[model samples]
Target: MKKTRIAALAAVLAFAGATLPASAQTALSENQILQSLQSAARVAPPNLSAALIANAVQEHIKNNPGMPITWTPLQLLDGLAQINVQIQFALNSDIIRPESYATIGSIADALHHPILAGYKFVVTGNTDTTGDRMKNLELSQRRANAVMNALVTVFNVDPARLEAVGLGQENLQDVQNPTDPINRRVQLINVGKYLPGK
Candidate 1:
């Protein structure tokens, strides 16, 4: 695929530089590859996309205290497993809800520890099944803020260490069912982590 795009771009450049040698196209491809590599390096080390981080947040936190890294998105239920990083809430409610607190709390707890200290995070709010797009967006923002505030005020999480944002209803349907109960969630994303893989 990369070769294809490079070839296509080279062809265009070749067309414009008709008087130049065909070899010039090779330089263009080289340049294209160089740029691509540079960009990839920027997000290398399994850079977690917002989607993955969001999914992880919604999952229930069931990690052991000994582990350096815990992913709640991988909880098991009656032989079935639930992904951490996503937590559900009632319509229009910014409440941390129940059991769900375990997930977010563990994350805040992890960040509070000395090993993972110095990292930052984001609390993104989402909603499903009950409001107009604009209204949902506003509510989502409120919820995100509420969740962030809870982490800071109640859990002793640092205020400067986190951000709260509302994705509204977008990115929810990107997974399976758009209107499913699982779609309503809050995704916690860690800073300097979950970047794209090389």
Candidate 2:
């Protein structure tokens, strides 16, 4: 029985040797490795290993090029600090249209979740050139503030976690059209110190 256990441990070590990151593989102590394995045993289900999850994350990145994903859960054992969120608006309106409630709810849920709870957001409002530039600027600022209020009051995001600002028609999405629907949007860029954990 002891021999079989040693053999299994050896096999696990060899498997780790083949796939573990250089940082982890080199510095991870025997106890740490065993603990990691034990944790893995509890969390990983049948047909799924830590390596398989790593592979899926890699494949997801390879399959979807130009995305901002760089790390996986295996790498993010250390907690994250903050995250970004973007929301869009109609022309000259501060109200989050009823149709976009679901998306807004998802953002709230993400903000409330354990992974992204600590993050702060800058809710930037943008607009198309369908109206006067100065008016668009003022309107955009109002829209941005409205969004901030909705997120804080309606969605229950921490007021400290949000900042609302307006860019007006400055950063046009479809520069060629100058007033495209795609331009009328908000992008929640991860501002301070958070990367998307896969």
Candidate 3:
């Protein structure tokens, strides 16, 4: 039994040592290395954006040459930190319109991809400075939450992996025009680790 246990430990050690890259070991201490190796053993699921999925499909087709690709669960969830989708709600209200479906659907589709199954994201709502500061903040929060709810209830995305926050007029893309429609936007940020297990 002792010999069998020793063999098992040896095999585990071998696997751990084999999987870790040399460059990764350069900065980590012995304890950190052990922790990292243990974490690495766990397979992380992919969480992706719709734009990224689309780009990945395009690349896949390019590489394969002469094959059609389906958009269902596109199996993509890597590359890029953010994808900007234009999602607009009704003016002065948090009601999402039918015209917004194309962009929102894309976002939902990305979150539904299997490659990005375990990923978490932040959906930030921003508003123009045309309204009172406090009201704008509250409005933005509502808009953000509305989008989050849509992703959860309508798209079947994992609610636990999504968070909504309101930036209000704080980070306006159009600095010159406080009332610019461009200032009113929702930004999706992938809060997941880029390389995972860092």
Question: 20-134 in candidate 2: lDDT tens per residue?
Answer: 3212223333343233322321222333322343344345445435423232222211121211123545545787776565555544555565545644455656676677755
Query: What C-alpha RMSD separates each model from the true structure?
Result: 20.8, 19.5, 20.5
Task: Kindly report which residue stretches of model 1 are placed more than 4 angstroms away from their true locations once superposed.
Answer: 1-84, 88-90, 173-176, 193-198
Supply candidate 3's per-residue lDDT for 143: 88
lDDT (CA) per prediction: 0.47, 0.47, 0.53
TM-scores for candidates 1 onward, in order: 0.51, 0.51, 0.55
Give residue 110's error in model 1 in angstroms: 1.6
Give the number of the best model, judged by TM-score.
3
Query: Between 2 and 3, whose lDDT is larger?
Result: 3
Count of clashing pairs, candidate 1: 21
Pairs that collide, model 3 = 46-115, 46-116, 46-117, 47-116
Candidate 2 accuracy as TM-score: 0.51
The sequence of per-residue lDDT tens digits that candidate 3 reaches over residues 46-144 is 554333433543554455443122212113322223333346577788899876754565566556545555566767676766767557767877888
Ordered from best to worst lDDT, the candidate numbers read 3, 1, 2
lDDT of 1: 0.47
Pick out the ten consecutive residues of candidate 1 with the lowest summed lDDT. Answer: 75-84
